[model samples]
Target: MGEDHMERLIEGHKRFLAEVFPGRKSQFHLLAETQAPEWLFITCSDSRVLPDLILGTGPGDLFITRNAGNVVPLTSQDVDGCTATIEYAVEVLRVKHAILCGHSDCGAMKAALDRAGLDALPKARRWLQHVEAAFAHRQPVNSAEGESAELASLIRGNVVAQLWNLKAQPSVVRAVDEGRLTVHGWYYDILSGRIEEYDEELRKFVVLGE
Candidate 1:
């Protein structure tokens, strides 16, 4: 089964090289030279959250980083992949927009809500501590989510908590203060396939289109 999966991936690459790459050869060549993406997208590592597919973004359009729970640690001394990527994206890439996105049915949030499953996964157990702040930031549970309401609320709260952490990053602060960057928090509902943005002034999540 593993070999079959690998073969499928190889075949997919071959197809891209043969059928897709030629049409986009010029675009790829230019990207090969240099990339100047306008957006820095940070989101969960869930396989379902395909940034390119969900946003209609292609290569060179977004500088992206993903991790479980889409966390941005608030502790200033905490140095990890997420913070490093953020600093580089803000300072070097000079991305104008930094989007921190969280989604419904997230495993990280689930684990954070119930820690029994994480006992065996020490690293994950420790890492999810970053999402503990989600409890205080929990959004109103949407009745539409039915039994999943609590989990969904927590996930949205995580988005807000992480977004705050993102903003507090030294580089992010300077950039925002200088009017060089804008930060956004988003909650994506898998069932409805809609996105909600956290409104700073309103202190609530509003449908993205609204």
Candidate 2:
């Protein structure tokens, strides 16, 4: 079974090299030399959340960083991958926009809600502690989500909390103050295939393109 899955991936790579690569050879050649992506996308490791597919962005468009819960850990004595990526994206890449996006039906959020199983996964338990603030920032429950409404609310709240952490990064703070960067918080609903951007002024999530 494992070999079959590996073969499938190998075949997919073969197809990309033979069919897809030729059409975008020039783009790849240029990207290989250097990348000047304008957006810094921080999102979850969830397989269902494909930033390129949903945003219609290809390579060289977004500088991306991913973790289990889409976290942007607050600056501290200890350096984490997420914060280090954010610092580089802001200071070195000079990305114009930084997007902190969380998705619905997230397993990370599920584990956060019920930590009984976390005892077996010590590393994950420690990592999820970053999302504990989500409980305080929970959004108003939406009836449209049915039984998953509460979970969705918590997920959105995580987006907000992490967005705050993203902004707190020293590089991000400097970039924003210089009027060169903008930060956004987003909740992606896999079921509806819709994205909601948090409105800082209104303090609510509004559907993207609406």
Candidate 3:
């Protein structure tokens, strides 16, 4: 099974080299040397959430960091991948915008909702503690979500929680205070194929582009 999956990935890479790479050879050449992405996209590791595909962005457009829950830990004492990536994107790369996106049916949020199988996964269990604040920030359940309404609310709440953590990063704080950075929270609904941006002024998630 593993070999079959590897073969499939190899075939995809071959197609990229044969078909896709040729048309964008110059783009690849410049990207190989250096990247000056303007957006810092922090999103979940869920395979369903493809930032480039949904946002119509390409390489060199976004500096991305992904984790199970799109978490940005607020610990100054501990050095973690997510926080370190944020520091680099803000202080070094000078990314102008940082977006924390959560998706519908996120496995991380589901696990946080129910600790049923968490005992078997120690590291994941510990990591999920960061999302505990989601319960407090839970948005009102939307009837349109049907059976998944409750879970969806929690997922959106997690986005808000993580967004706050992202803003609290020292580099991000400095950039924002200097008027060089703007942070946003987003919820991507897999079923609807749409994105909702959290409006700080309205304190609600509003549909993007509409």
Clash number for every model?
0, 0, 0
The 10 consecutive residues of candidate 1 with the worst lDDT sum are 141-150
User: What C-alpha lDDT, on a 0 to 100 scale, does residue 124 get in candidate 2?
Assistant: 95
The alpha-carbon lDDT assigned to residue 148 of candidate 1 equals 80
- Overall lDDT per candidate, in order of appearance: 0.92, 0.92, 0.92
Q: Which runs of model 3 end up more than 4 angstroms from their true locations?
A: none
Deviation in Å, model 1, residue 85 alpha carbon: 0.5
| Candidate 3 clashing pairs, residues 3+ apart or interchain | none
Per-residue alpha-carbon lDDT of model 2 for 79-167, expressed as tens digits? 98889888899999999999999998999999999999799999899899999999998998578784487788899999999999888
Clashing pairs in 2: none
lDDT minimum window of 10 residues, candidate 3: 140-149
| Model 1 stretches astray by more than 4 angstroms | 76-78
Candidate 1 vs 3: which has more lDDT: 1
lDDT of 1 at 49: 87
Candidate 3 local lDDT, 1-210, one digit each (tens): 599989999999999999999999999999998999999999999999999999999989999999998888885367999898999999999999999999999999999999987999999999999999899999875787844878989998999999998888889989999999999999998988989999989889999977
